[model samples]
Target: MEMQRIMEFPDRIMDKRPRKKPRLTWDMHPPPQPQPPIPPPKVLPTTYHNQEVVNGVAPNHAYPSLFFRGLTRNGSPPWRPDDKDGHYVFAVGDSLTPRYRIIGKMGEGTFGQVLECFDNEKKEAVAIKVVRSINKYREAAMIEIDVLMRLARHDINGARCVQIRNWFDYRNHICIVFEKLGPSLYDFLRKNSYRSFPIDLVREFGRQLLESVAFMHDLCLIHTDLKPENILLVSSEFIKVPDYKFLSRAMKDGSYFKNLPKSSAIKLIDFGSTTFQHQDHSYVVSTRHYRAPEVILGIGWNYPCDLWSVGCILVELCSGEALFQTHENLEHLAMMERVLGPLPPHMIVRADRRADKYFRRGTRLGWPDSSTSRESMRAVWKLHRLPNLIMQHVDHSAGDLIDLLQRLLRYDPAERIKAKEALRHPFFSRDPKRHGYPL
Candidate 1:
C-alpha cells in the first residue's frame, strides 16, 4: 500500500546542532528495581530523576509501597509484599480504573510494565503502557502522547502505526491504552528459535516497514527506535511450515515445524524516543544494534538515521540475528566496516570530536591494533560483507535484495536510500512467483 502523506511542513530548519559530548556506552540498564526488604547499615541513596531511594525510601520521605506484579515466575503464584519502587504494583483481576481490569501482563521494560487489560466499558482487550511515577518517565510519556495524537490526527485510517485507544494519569503513572495486537517481530523470531523467514516473507515485511517509515517521515517525525521489537504484527494467527533441519536433528511433538505469520500487516510502536525533524539533532538516539554510524560518530543525525535503522532491521529479519552485535563504539564501527565495507571517507572526515578517536590518520578505522582481545578481533573479521551475508541465507532472490541493502546501509546518510525511494526498489517491485520463491 502506498504511504499517504497526512501533512507536510515547509522546509525544516536544522538550527540547533548540539556540541560533541562524550559517547554514551550501551549499558545493559535494568528496570527500576527497589532495594531488598531489609536495610543494611550505612545505606546509600540510589538517585534517579531527583527522586532518591535510600533503603527503599525516598531520602527523608518514606517510599510508598504501591508496586505489585500481576504474575510471578513461580508456577503457582501468590500475592506477595508489594514493591516500593516507582512502578505501579498491580495484580491479576485488579482494576486499573473504574472501567479497566487487568487480565495479564503484556511485558515489562525500563520505562515500566505493560498490562493486558479487559476494558469492561468497551468489551474488548487492550494493552496499557503504565509509565513509572518518576518525573522523567512521566515527561517522556507526555511527549509520546503528543506525537501519537499528532499521528492519529493526520493518519486518518491508522494504517502505519499503532492506534492509541485512550490515556490517563493514575496514581502519578501515565497509563496509555492501545489496541491489542500480535507479538512483536523480535518475539516471533525468538519463539521460532531464531529461524530466518522465507525470502518472500522478508520482501513483504520490508515493503510494509518502509511504507510505515515513509508515513512517519512525511509527517516530519522520526521514530528513533525502529527495531523488530517495536514492529508488531496485526494478527497472531500463523501456519506451521515443515522445518526439515529440525526434523533431521531430532524432533518432538511439533518441533519439526515452524510457525509463519498468516499475515504481514504491521504497526510501528514505541514513540517515546520519536523526535521532530527540527528538534535538537545532536544527542545519541536509537538502540545499540540499529544505531546509525553518524550517531556513534557524534555527528548530527536527521531523518536518514531512521532509514539506517530500517536497513539493520531488514538484515536481522533475513539472517535471524542482529547485523552488528556489539556494545562498544569502536567495535561497532569495526564490525560495520567488515559487513558494509569501509566508512565513507567524507563521513570519517566529519566525525565528531569525541568520535574522532575511533578513526585514525584519515578514513581508516583502527581495528586489530586497537581491539581489546583476539576474540573481539576474530568476531569482527568473521563477519561477511553485505552481498556475501545476503547470499548465505537467501537464494533465488539475493541480487535485488543485496543491491537494495547496500544502498540502505550506505555509510553516508546523504547516499542512503530514503523510505519512499526504497519502496520503489526492484526488491519490492519484483514478483516472487516468477523467481520461484515460496509464498
Candidate 2:
C-alpha cells in the first residue's frame, strides 16, 4: 500500500525573521464548477444480511482489506455501573491483558485525558486517549482508530503525519498506539512568531498545506480543525536492536545530530474531528479565525471551508498578522465584508440554526456591525495600500502580494481558488526544483 504524501519540507531550515515589507503581487483563479453529486445506493448488498444492528453498525459486515485493519463491529455498551451496569474504574494496568507502565499524562480534552506510555515488546512511545464510559458512544473511539488505520498508509515524503501501529480495547478505555513526533506546530509558531518566516518561505509552507488539503478533499475527508497547532514534525528515525549500542553511543554524543538526518516533514495531527464526505451529516466544525464564511452563517458547508482557513494562515504568514481578529461575532462578519464583500444570500439561508448543537453562543460568527464595519472597510483600504506602507522594509510592496491573497481569501465559496489551482499561480514562478511543490 502506498503512503500518500501531502507536503514536503526541507531540512535544516533557517529560523531567520521575516522582512517587514508589504506583500508582493500574486495570482488567484476561481474554483472549478461543483462536481456532479453521486447517486445513493438503492439496493442492499449481501454484506447487509442477517446481522445485528449494534452501535450504528450493519449485522453482516464486509470488512475492507488493505486499509481497514482492526475495525470494531460497533459494539454496544451496556448500562452505566451506578445504574448497576455502566460504572467501572480502571487502574493503569487493569485494562491491558499484558499492561505496561503509565509514563505520564499528555493532555485532557473535551473527550477525555490522554496518557503517554511505552510498549515493552515494541519498545516504542505511544499516546493513549481515554474517554469516560458512555453506552451510546462506546464505539466512538473505535471509529477514530479505524479512521487512523485507514490513513496510516498515507505518506508524503517529508510530511510528518502519524500512523497507528496498533489498537486494543481495555475496560472503559480504548487505547490506540501512534507514531510520536516532536513539538506541534502551535509550539513552533509561538517560539517562532509571524516575523520568523520570510514571504518565500511562508509561500512554500502554504503550498505544502494546500497540497494536503487537496489530497484530503480528493478523499472526501474534511479536517475540521486545520491549524498550525495540529501540524507535527518528525525528525529522528527509530534505531533497532542490532544498533542498540551504537544508538546508545549516538544518543550520548548526539550521533543523530552529527549525521544530520533529512528534514522532518509536516504532518496533520488530530483525526478525531475528521469526517468523510457523504458519510458525515454535520456541517459545523473548525476554529473561529480559520472558520469559513458559510460556517459563520450556519450554512451546510463542505471542503471549501478548509481552503478558506488555508488562505487565512497564508496571509498571517505573509503579513505577520491575522486577516480577521475581531472582538465580537458581528464585528468578525464586518471585517470579512471589508475584504470579500457581503455574505451571499444562499449562505445566510443555510446558516446553522442549532447553535447549542456545535459551539458556544457570543463566540465569533463572522458578522460585522455598522460602526466596526466601516472601520473594517478602512482597514481593507490600508491593507490594499500595504505596498506603499512597506516601502521602508524590502524592495516589494503590498501590490506584490495582494492579488494572491485576494484570490485565496475570497468570501464566495463557489468562487474560492482551490489548492491545485493555487499551486500553479505565478508567485511560485521561480526555482521549480527547489520550491516546486509536488502537491
Evaluated with lDDT, which candidate comes out highest? 1
Poorest stretch of ten by lDDT in candidate 1: 19-28
Q: Could you give me the TM-score of model 1 versus the true structure?
A: 0.80
Off by over 4 Å in 2: 1-100, 135-139, 153-160, 193-195, 236-264, 319-321, 326-328, 344-401, 432-439
Candidate 1 lDDT over 1-439, as tens digits, reads 2221111112222212121121111111211222222222232221112121222111233323223222212121222332566787877656665457667677777778788777765677778888888888988887887787777767667878898777766555788888887778876776676777888889989998998899999999999988988988887667777776668776445566677887889889989999989887647899888999989987788989999999998888998888888778899998998887788888888887888777669688877664378878887989998899989988767999999998888888888999999999988989978867568
* lDDT (0 to 1) per candidate: 0.74, 0.50
Return the lDDT, model 2, position 337: 60
TM-score per prediction, in order, is 0.80, 0.60
lDDT for residue 21 in candidate 2, whole number 0-100 = 20
How does candidate 2 score on lDDT? 0.50
Clashing pairs in 1: 67-89, 68-89
